[model samples]
Target: MNNSFSPRTGSPQAGSQQVGSQQVGRLYGVGVGPGDPELMTVKAIRTIAACPVVAYFCKRGTKGHARRIASDAITAEHEELPMVYPVTVELPPDHPDYGRQIEAFFDESAERIAVHLAAGRSVAALNEGDPFFYGSFMHLFLRLASRFPTEVIPGVTSMVSSASLLPRPLMLRDDVLSVIPGTLDEESLVRTLRHTDAAVVMKLGQNLPKVRRAIAAAGLADRAWYVERASMAEQRVLPFAEAPDTAPYFSQIVIPGEGKRG
Candidate 1:
């Protein structure tokens, strides 16, 4: 793995040259939906099925959640590209080396994907949930979209899936929704919760206790719902107060809006 990766800003394929069927291999950001294979869109399925190259992100030695979601649809002949993160939470966010390490990883990954794109071999990067919503696929897209033809396929997000588990709507007319991650500081978390009509707090893995306190301080603890692995078979839904001390990375706290039209 070369740490110093720099590719020239020139398309390998001529504007008129075609690879498989098109001038260049277009990159497809395919959203495989939240946990469920059935929830994948028809276009996503078709695009993935048509592509020979499929890429996904995962922790080292583990299969990607996005790839697992699309496992049923994948064929034996598809070339798998596992873009494993070189470092995850191993260094402080403010550390200069942290930024450098991540940037190097993305640059290398982009260059690797660009090879397929330049050769006209279409590549589909599978993403769990909606690709644009806090997705790692966006990193590759930012580096490759301008140079290669790219398309994004939308799918069901966990926020919406969790909302469906309840009897009421996530929001009604004029209801504002705030989506926050528990990674924020306690004070900031409290402020965001207090100001929002409805809040969906994600990344509650180790932040559940803090997030719970923030919800209580913001005076929405009773109105909040703790949902884990939404839409999955092992899903669990509970009131915020009743939720366990710990939660998985996929868990979330949904604070319903007070606004409901009569």
Candidate 2:
């Protein structure tokens, strides 16, 4: 039941004759955008629809969200490779070997994906949001780029999606934009917010209190907006003054006018 992945090894056999004649297989890192299937870009849809095989990252025992987003665009003839990420915090702390075990999983996944690429089959690996924005697809990209012909297709990112759901613009004319991870330490967060025009703090699940203090210290508390599950049916957007005691993992805090100082 433990989910894990290992780097792929060796190349896949050449695909059908017609594809083989093309002489080169392509690896596509396709971004599927946020949770909505309709939000996918035209380029991303076209690349995935044409590829012979489609790959996606998923933990064991769960359906692949990215695949579902692009399901309508894919044909039954394509292949699905679900690279698993088995590392979960639920495992006992004393397991000791968990870290190494997880690393091996990624290695194996990369290797498995490489096989399909070696063949003349173009592989489209689906990603949630933009491929490069905190997505696991980056790991596969790093593994396969040097070994094969790879292309990255950008998609709408969660930050942008979240901002769009809000009534106010994320940034107005001449406003600075600062994107900070909530995981930053108190000092770092405060320093980063001091001179920014507008700010977005991502990954606010457990760091809400710290981030709130930093915003208060920077004197930008009133300008903040808290948004959770943006663009989805369960979305919630509230001003900083009315935000809950804790924010969800998918939540973000935005300060639209803070950029005027810079």
Number of the predicted model whose lDDT against the real structure is largest? 1
List, residue by residue over 147-215, the lDDT tens digit for candidate 2.
Answer: 776667889988988888766788887888889999899999999999788889988877899999999
lDDT of 1 by residue, 63-147 (tens): 8799889998789979999999877768876798989998999999999999988877878899889989988789998999878
State TM-scores per candidate. 0.88, 0.83
Residue 81, candidate 1: C-alpha displacement in angstroms = 0.6
Q: On a 0 to 100 scale, what is the lDDT of residue 63 in model 1?
A: 80
In candidate 1, list every pair of residues with a backbone clash.
25-120
Q: After superposition, how far is residue 102 of candidate 1 from its true place, in Å?
A: 2.0
**Clash count per candidate:** 1, 17
Best candidate, TM-score: 1
Q: What is each predicted model's overall lDDT from 0 to 1?
A: 0.84, 0.79
Q: What is model 1's C-alpha RMSD?
A: 6.8
Off by over 4 Å in 2: 1-22, 91-99, 258-262
